[model samples]
Target chain A: MGEFHFYTKLDQTLLLGVKAGNAEELLAGIQIVPDSSIYHHTHRYLHQHHYLSPEPPNDFAYWTAHVLGDVVLGERLWSVDIVGFQSIAELRQTFVNILEGHLASTRRRIDCAGGQEFHFMASRTYVLPTPHVAHNLAEFAHILNKVSINSLYFHVFDAKLRLERGENDFSRWFRSLGKTELAEKSSRLDPYSHTLDGLRREIIAMVEKHGSD
Target chain B: MARIEDYASFVGQATIDELFLLARHLEGKSVQNVNSTAVGGGVAEILSRMIPLLKQLGVEARWDCIKGDEKFFATTKKFHNGLHGVAVDVGDDEYEHFLEVNRRNAGEMTFGDIVFVHDPQPVALIENRAEIGRRWLWRCHIDFSRPDPKIWKFLDQFVARYDAAVFSAPAFAQKLSVPQVLIAPSIDPLSDKNKELSEEAIASVFERFGIDRSRPIVTQISRFDYLKDPLGVIQAYKLAKQRLDMQLVLAGGGATDDPEGPAIMEQVKEQASKDADIFVLFLPPASDIEINALQRGSTVILQKSLKEGFGLTVAEALWKAKPTIAGAVGGIPLQIAHKYSGILTHSIEGTAQWIKQLISSPAYASKLGENGREHVRNNFLITRHIKDYLLLFISLFHEGDIVYL
Candidate 1:
């Protein structure tokens, strides 16, 4: 009811991860802003990008505000594709790279110890551009299951997307060992004007609708 | 009339002044708290009281909760039981459900300068520290001295992410690599529930509840959860009733997240139905004054919890200078100083024995009540808690900033 205070800087731990390369740059940028100033700037930024409009209808404004302020939405920023890797070797290498860059050597060692125990199956498919990321995620999960690591995982896609798509056809298919629709769409659209251009149009339209709603 | 300063005599003005000074020192510091529910539990109650006081003191303190669905709550209830050394079925779906809720809550709430995530229910909110800059502190109110390995490992990941962790008792602390602090929970002596009641006020409350002033009353006011052991309280009262002319009052309400509460309450009602003297009260959330009246009107108070997270109600009864017998678990030890302040027992038999002794011996009960009020004044009052939090907020900013002023 009072004035909504937007945090100026990105969260410190999130910033630390970004500095280490565990997270993205754009996200880490918000760590330094004042709390109230963040909302003002982000609202303006989203408006310019057509993610929102200044004078959208009440419903559009409400949902737009909700999405912007929601911490759940921001969680997808550094989302690694758990199912994207081809092999345990690939997963190991990517983790090694992350540890060498984004985390301390000691932390990386811990991550590796935990990573080795993880086993992602084609069974735990999630809604993303690829299915393999889910498999890759299984590595960390396996480690978590085996080891005594008391860590918190957001599982952003697992929590929000899985529920939205429903437990039927799409979710069941995603949980299977097959490929996902988004990845296929992107691949098909990669070479053609229809897929990329059509996606662009959709994003623009969604942003417009969100802005003015 | 019941402003914060009204508690000065009990908590000491010098102590209150020092807390204000500490809060002022941390005026620019940002702090946050994360817990399960914002309304039903003790953490929420304390935060609701503490946050406003923090703002009044000029330090910015925020509160947040970890989001969970019905399935997530069910899993976490198992996690809670397991943390207290109860074995339950916790498979992959349970773990996934738990993570799903944390992810949802983490996405919805805002982070502060320093984050204080309370209990296991919302521990996952710390995962965002990789993106947020404020210092994060994990506050554990539950006893985890002998937690189940399966559940503890799942929680350890998030606990390790924070800068520091706080526990209520020494026994409850685990072997964490991070720095840990010990700060016991406290009650507001100036609050309506804890303030002294007049003869007329006490009498009116007893009359309204249909409690005869002639008969000695024994009451236990807490949530209708098994951990609080309301049915066990009834059993203890029944045992004590065989020797003395007394009435038993089991007054408690339900929490939103605790789905098993209604079933537990039904069981308690069934147990209490054998005797007419057993008064089973299902009080609403806004029944704080009624609770105050019940505690005040009672000859003795009981908090026979099997597991507890600092029974503030015990402290509330003790603050009113009522002789109380409580189970020695969680934060109960901090409030009761054995025979000095109040009595602490483990089993229903021990609770019954203490109740019988206190009810039969009026002089001893009065002596214990006198000692208990001073105990609350010296340690468990809200002013002391405010000081502890203010100092915590100040510690986040400076490594060597100390002032005699």
Candidate 2:
């Protein structure tokens, strides 16, 4: 596993919002581009993914209100009626609209500082491959080679992505993704192993094999 | 031998004879109870009374406690809270340490024909059951209605290995393959805590504690644990005191295995110190008679637990013919019949309202207490507990057979 650092731009932004002690800035940063950072993407993904028969509201509102010290905004965000939204995308849009309205109306705002340094430091930490990058076996293999992996969280994301696309075995899909050696190695991978470095090494070896081929 | 016939007066001759008949079936079977503490908490208190009674009834029963360091206890305390549906910090290290302690205890601990492992503390002891060749029963004394899924899943692995699981209330039971038995924990009426004390003894207890008996007394007797919500009790008392003059007694002791007791007790003391009427008595471990006296002296007994295993204090107060106002959680409902025997409250506001009602209407309070005592006598006494265990032990051996009493 890599050091406890923020690997995504969204994490850096959220950390800034957390440090700024501003809920408006945090919500602004979180909903910036919808899919900008893993944090933003994951929330959007989870929201969209479970949209029809979605689970209860995630901790976005709680983090916004409690951790970021914006009770008014948090309560407003939490009070958003998600009953009629048919998809996670629709829910995310509604949530963003509510958050934006709150942000515009609220007079309180914290001046966010030290973004560059925070970004530089966070770049060194491990972050899971984005859901988009992990959409397929080939893209997943490619992303795994470039970034540090958080194995447990990544596995869940990968499993869900695979289940959505009708793929189960990484090796079998790697064969279809045209990385046969990687697929062979993927079949032998211990899914239960929590070590990121071991998984990183396995991915690197498979990538090396693909490069040689 | 503390003969079954000795309990004739409290439980009646027929009940004793029925228990004796059940005990005869398991006359020579070895029954051992393994818990986390030997004193302090209800599990230890129950085992201390229960083991001897089991022995007297001719079931070769013994009690054993698991050995653990401060760290292990801290983890187990978190586990206890987690099992009660409280959000607790039970990380990987805490989990490993808990299992390591259990594994160590599992190696050294001996068993009986039927090993009764009480609560989550010593639950993993069933790992050694296969080798030891003993029928293990996991006796869960806490509410497991909505346990932290991670902790519950971890404990469930060990629980599934048991021959059967015992819960204090039907609501506390989870769906498991093993036969689940609802065995409500009981208070020994003959014990110092539940036994009738003379007016002088009761008055002396009030005098020692500097409690003013002139005003109505509201007492909550429980261990100094967050789950007991001692702070909430003080808040309820303050609310009630706004309308009526009452002296609140928060009397309890610490459990050896619960490391959080001292910290929680300090918080209780601070909250209680705001009002001079609220007396915080950190009673010593063996101060059962004092506890009994405090209950006897009280106008209304409060057990405002945020979460409860069984809240034996409710039964203890009810047995003494005192109207109890307790939280509507866990096994408290089984003891209290809501206005019929005792009142069950959901919040501090509700508790305060009931406290005021009970204190104002002395006639109604006395009636409730009378009903409560009968309710306890019919159900919550230790004689019924012993009979349940004997029946449970017999059921373990005779698996499919319907053992009629």
Candidate 3:
């Protein structure tokens, strides 16, 4: 195997100028927004509150439930297994379906206040390389303990979900290194269920135990 | 005097190293920051601190301010008020003068790889963008929720000339040709206003201001401006005091660009009345340590602004683990999660109710304070701010829409 270089992501959020005061409007914006916007609405909280446990709800569910006061629709939106989708298109479709279904079934119309309107936003990301590189399994586990949560998030959540890499950057790199056990353990982990800090701790533990084996 | 590494103690050494790594990506590009003032205001204060740190991190950064006469400044102040949804009649000459001042400033200034212009004061500088091919970003630092259509329409034309427009809050943005990015403002945790104060310092500051520490203190620290609703803060305090015995402290100073500070202060003083419990302190710009002591000494802090960019005072109070009650307008919601971190209020009644509720429940207020501090540390620190700005600068160079990791 060769050296595995880690990269981190920094995001700049750009407003799309498209806003929604009600569920129908929100659905329309969701349909037309770019893939980055879809990704942003889903993973926004994951990045912002990376230290909190039992990962916070996505912007869509939180706004609808808390702001819009549509508890049932909020539950439906929240229940969408984000990690189950292979691409942003699929994840976006799931939201579109849920919102469309709710708007059709429920005759209740809810409009947030003037400032409470949900602003459609997208992120322009800059992927930069970090100083950490691992030539072997021992080096990789040691470096994992020191890398920033952003680097860990880049390798885990960003690589797995946004890039549609079939697997996270760590598992893919591990597969290349012929460490099938470490790769499988990492591949089995879900990135959104826990905080990024929690995710890093779990991965570090998996890597360390694999090294001992 | 504080180095980039001095922040390592607050946000760890790894976070400091990440800044160095990010700066490496901008090795070749020079960043030039232009605003209206070099001191006093938030933009100037932020740049004065950030430019030196950027240079220390190996990025060539410089700052300059536009030279404007009293007429120009007064007109810009009108523009400022107009942008905050205030009605002000702006004549054609005022418009022409705004452009003339921008033209003079733009002609005299040298461009960098990236020219970052802050607020509406220097927005028209983008008119010269075609002559000089470089990335230009217009960062609006006002409560742009509801601007006067006349002023906004006039400024929108010049603003569209920029590569991207950045606002402090999501609601502040409008539909425009350029991409409107959202970047919340931040406070330096190590700065005088936000730094830790000793018990003696807090006590002395309280004594010097004649505020009795024996009783609970309810305070609002902000520029005594109309938009800040200092008079409303006094009313809320008076209402809350009807039920609970507490001291009200309203402390703030004026910015170099703003001329209405003394007038607003007078209004606040008259509203506060002769009640010794109601203390109105007009502080100097260099009184950050005293401000920190005052914030630390307060039992509950209030930022009942009718309009705000980000309500940075909320962040400052929350950073000190002081339970806060602020208007839900603008960026206050970002800092407070409604009874979770701090309380968000809509009117004078709501603000007063929350003040009473927070003071009545010590355990709940303490919990809110803890959550508020954690929230500020995670999202609103200078490290996160520098990272965001670095990302924004780097994205200007990249051509395509950056969706995939």
Candidate 4:
């Protein structure tokens, strides 16, 4: 089964909140991180693989309405003014409740008995790399601070998407910014030869080594 | 230096005086033209004539050619076809190669007061304009009304960065963010290709090509490109020959950058070999006097193009007072006023019909030829072309500045 990769900052923040069992820390993580940096990679990955969620997101309401394909649910989600929540825990709970409500209301089943019984098949589950490899919170913090590497990884990721679709706009624009080596490497990248998880692991290792230096 | 007054006899003193007035406005500004080729194509032909004339009018003008290898040119040739609405497979690799070549050329290029980049070959040079700091103008000499969506989208980015864009016809203009100027291409009346030739010289050309002077001759002069529809011209000639006894001359040569010419020439030769009435003469470059003789010797001229930039041959033929029948595509319609100056045809059958009618009715053919010559004299001459360019250069400094002439 193919694995899905998360942005290092997002992964680090989620790991910290889960370990500490603190929803407030998770909310702090979401707020502190620039939304575009996280969202741009997700949107590009989904769009490139032709796995886009119906109406692709341009903003919060559109993203919810189109991606989730539920206008009323999207309106309810939009009603929670992201900035108005007094605590990160409250914001976290609101998101969790809306998702749980959507799952409960939209559940479906099929009966397949006509004298003969058939076995139901389960689809392969997506996996994410464990974030515990970093020894401590300090190591995790150091990794997250390497935002320049995140930006580099974004170029590498975006370039692969463009190459797969036989487009060079991103790479050309990348070169125009005086990033010739990065642009050249991006054009030469073969997406099939390297998986997203594999690239993420390599970037994490590089960031950890750089922190040691 | 050929002065502006040299064209007075052909275009009149009033036009010459007007051009001089406009040239005075462009006094010290230097104009640099960038294109892909130095020979063979209309862009090179026009620049060769225009630059010297621009100098004579006291407007400093220079020309440069962008360097590219075979693969780069092969890719750009596809771009040329794609821009003309022809389906071509231009993927990421092609785009990469195109940009790589442009990047190399961009490193060597230095701009002037007015940098005129021609066609798609050197269009990407505008990417360096921020550092160079010059007013850049992109002159599109091809029909770009409908272009490949992907290619057009990519080119549009560079085009948007330019100060202004120039097109040969109003129909060729796209909805560009920058201002667009419509200036039709012109033929040099004093050049070897359009200069007056003696009957002896015309007869010698016929003898050289072994063309039978006894039979009425119909000719189409253009490069052997599929867009020119040379095979379709042969079909039209065959159809016309069914009703009347006549000879056909398909005379043209290839440009260096156009790799499709030899293959298209082979296809044209194979099509023409079916009959002896047709003469497929592949003239060498700079055979202007020979081209002039061929146009003058023709009873009727045909330019049956599927798509054209400006079809300068139509203007060249009309200037010779030949009853020209050109395809009703691209900038051909701008020159031919349909049943007035010359005829415009849409298909092989239509071209055949016009050729047959013009051959049979000498009086009507002669009248059309007379009207066509006058039209070219008043509009499509080099004198007017120089005036238009001078005014364009002057207008760049003064936006919303209208010149009353």
Q: Return the top candidate by TM-score.
A: 3
Listed in order, the DockQ scores are 0.01, 0.01, 0.53, 0.01
Q: Please, what are the lDDT tens digits per residue for candidate 4 over residues B143-169?
A: 876789888999999999998787786
Query: Per-candidate RMSD vs. true structure?
Result: 27.0, 22.4, 3.0, 27.0
Best candidate, DockQ = 3
Clashing pairs in 2: A47-A88, A48-A88
Worst 10 contiguous positions by lDDT, candidate 2 chain A? A116-125
Q: After aligning candidate 4 to the native by TM-score, how far in Å is the CA of A129 from where it should be?
A: 79
Query: By lDDT, highest first, what's the ranking?
Result: 3, 2, 4, 1
Error of 3 at A28 (Å): 1.5
Structure candidate 4, residue pairs in collision: none
Instruction: Please list the residue runs of candidate 3 whose C-alpha ends up more than 4 Å from where it truly belongs after superposition.
Output: A176-181, B212-215, B230-246, B253-278, B348-353, B360-364, B403-405
lDDT digits (tens) for residues A66-154 of candidate 4: 32345775576556543233333455466557645654676432221121111111111111122323233235434434322222333
In model 3, the number of clashes is 0
Sort the candidates on TM-score, descending order: 3, 4, 2, 1
TM-scores of chain A across the candidates, in order, are 0.17, 0.33, 0.96, 0.24
Clashes per candidate, residues 3 or more apart or on different chains: 50, 2, 0, 0
Q: Model 4, residue B199: displacement in angstroms?
A: 0.9
Task: Give TM-scores of the second chain, every candidate.
Answer: 0.84, 0.85, 0.91, 0.88
True contacts kept of 1: 0.00
First chain of model 2: TM-score? 0.33
Q: What does candidate 1's lDDT look like per residue over B1-405, in tens digits?
A: 345666666644544554554555665667777777889767788888888877776777777666667888888888887987777779997887787778777777777777777888888876777776678777877776578997898889989988777777645666677656667788876677776678888888778777787999999998788888887898888788888889998887774345677798778888878888888888877877788888888899999987776678888888788999998766675576566578888778888889999998999898788767766765677776776666555445543211221
